[model samples]
Target: MNTIYRLLLVTLFFVSQNNQAQKRIALFNQKDLKGWYAFGEEKGKTNNADELFSVENNMIRMFGPKAGYLMSEQSFRNFELTVEYRWNTDVNVVRKNNNKNSGVMYLVPAETPDILWPKGIQFQIKEGATGDFVFLQETTLNINGTKTTPGKSVVSKRFADAEKPIGEWNQLVIISKNGVITQKLNGKTVNQGTESSVTEGRILLQYEGFPIDFRKVNIKKSK
Candidate 1:
């Protein structure tokens, strides 16, 4: 190849790499819910408006008896997600469960039903230490390539460090890539597992009968 041709090719390659590296992805915009859709109770209330998701005091908060769901517009394959959230005190005069309850669910497939979502694996958000890691729906396999023994579930093997205090803004991080899932709470590794059922799926935030606050929920491509 000629010297000039080689130089031009090298410059083009450099430009391409730089553009990919500099890409700025927006998971959520402050002004309105640009990349999110409301499911469950809040769905019909929006009236097909552009900004369905609401923000108060710079935090996403939920209330009411009926459950709601907020999902990401774009599905993710392999990425690192960081979210911070706190639970708000319940206002129900009937005095049911006053404690906080909510969840950050990941690896959800595209064909999820409108009401039933617990079918997917749930990173629980409950009152006490139990909220840390309670595996639901999905099964966890053992190292021997067999499903885990009778009593134990996948959450036990992956996220023993799931303990977090109530009403506090806890940080949750999920790294999913190539069928491997790892989750952390408050900087502690809580769960790890491998599953081929899904490689990429939409993200969902639970609004199950309690008030919860979400500060930051963002994702970036892993290196």
Candidate 2:
């Protein structure tokens, strides 16, 4: 009888622990753009109307005219986000002479200004700067031990440069919890900030100029 009781208790403990584990959701379905919407210079326009954003060969390709972003329909907080991306080497006319620029923006509030970029914490994705942090609009972050002033934009430099070659894929991992944010590039921790003014909001994949491909955008929520 005691042996049976011990076995039941063990089973119950395992079940409880499993229930408390983090829940992961794949933001990209790898086949369609069902849970995402596009916003750009042409406000109120349809997503990928000009082929700026599309899913082909199991990857999300951003190639077309105008600069904008692809945003998630849902808001999130206290989660870890992982995405893999690579440059396409096809420059648009608008940014023909400039370096490739793009970013992954998160913690975007619902009331963000309806401009090319709203308020959020951006994981900088650009040539030679893949893991930097850009605080857009009025967002602020406490880097190291200094508290940044609000209502102004700031760029927090990454601790290191971890981008792969132009055409090679690189993985970006961002973890946000309790007002603290950490950014990793290619399996290395490159940047981190504390005391974020914005803690929860939507996610944005930027469309700066050159074409970029993204895959495996997944997020795991903390319990």
Candidate 3:
């Protein structure tokens, strides 16, 4: 009887642990852009506007004239986000001269201005600058144990260059919990900060006058 009781208790504990570990949400449905909405200069103009944000070959492709972003309809907090992205070889005519630029913006407040860019912390995605941090609209962060207060756009360089070559997919892992945020690129920890002004909000993928492809936007509550 004693042995049976001990086995039962062990089984229950494993079941509880598995349940907590399996709490994950797929932000992008591979078939289509079901839970996302586009915002930019060309939004709501015509049916063709949707073409800017479309699912092609099981990846979300952003290619169009205007510069804007696709925002998640839901907000999240205290989670770990994983996504893969690659730069498209075709750049828009207007932005061809400049290096490609895109980003994953998170912790946007509810009252942030509805403009080309919102008030949030951005994981800077650019040519040779992946994993850099950008604080938009006076947002604040504590970097390397020091608090930063740039009046407008504050940029923090990543600790190392971990981006793969152009056209190859790179993985990004962003973990935000208890006001602390850490960014990882290609499985390397590149940047981390604490005491972020905004703890929770929607996620935004930027369309900074360049073409990009994204896949597997997955999130799960941090254990």
Highest lDDT: give the candidate number.
2
Candidate 2 C-alpha error for residue 71, in Å: 0.6
TM-scores, each model vs. reference: 0.74, 0.87, 0.85
For every candidate in turn, the CA RMSD to the true structure comes to: 4.4, 3.1, 3.5
Better-scoring candidate (TM-score), 1 or 2: 2
| Residue pairs with clashing backbones, model 3 | none
What TM-score does prediction 2 earn? 0.87
- To one decimal, what is the Cα RMSD in angstroms of model 1 from the true structure? 4.4
For residues 1-223, could you state the per-residue lDDT of candidate 3 as single tens digits?
9999999999999998978866888899788877777777756322332555778898888866678788777788788999899988864424423458999999887666666788899999998888999998888899988988865788999999899999899999999998999999999999999999889888888888778899999988754
What lDDT is reached at residue 124 by model 3?
Answer: 96
Q: Any idea what lDDT model 2 has? A: 0.84
Instruction: Give me candidate 1's TM-score against the actual structure.
Output: 0.74
Estimate, for each residue in 1-223, the C-alpha lDDT of model 2 and write its tens digit. Answer: 9999999999999888766557678999899888888876755545453344778898998866678888887889899999999988754424423558999999998777546788999999988778989898878989989977675557888999899999899999999999999999999999998999999998889888778889999998874
Q: How far out, in Å, is residue 1 in model 2?
A: 8.3
**Displacement of the residue 18 alpha carbon in candidate 2, Å:** 4.9
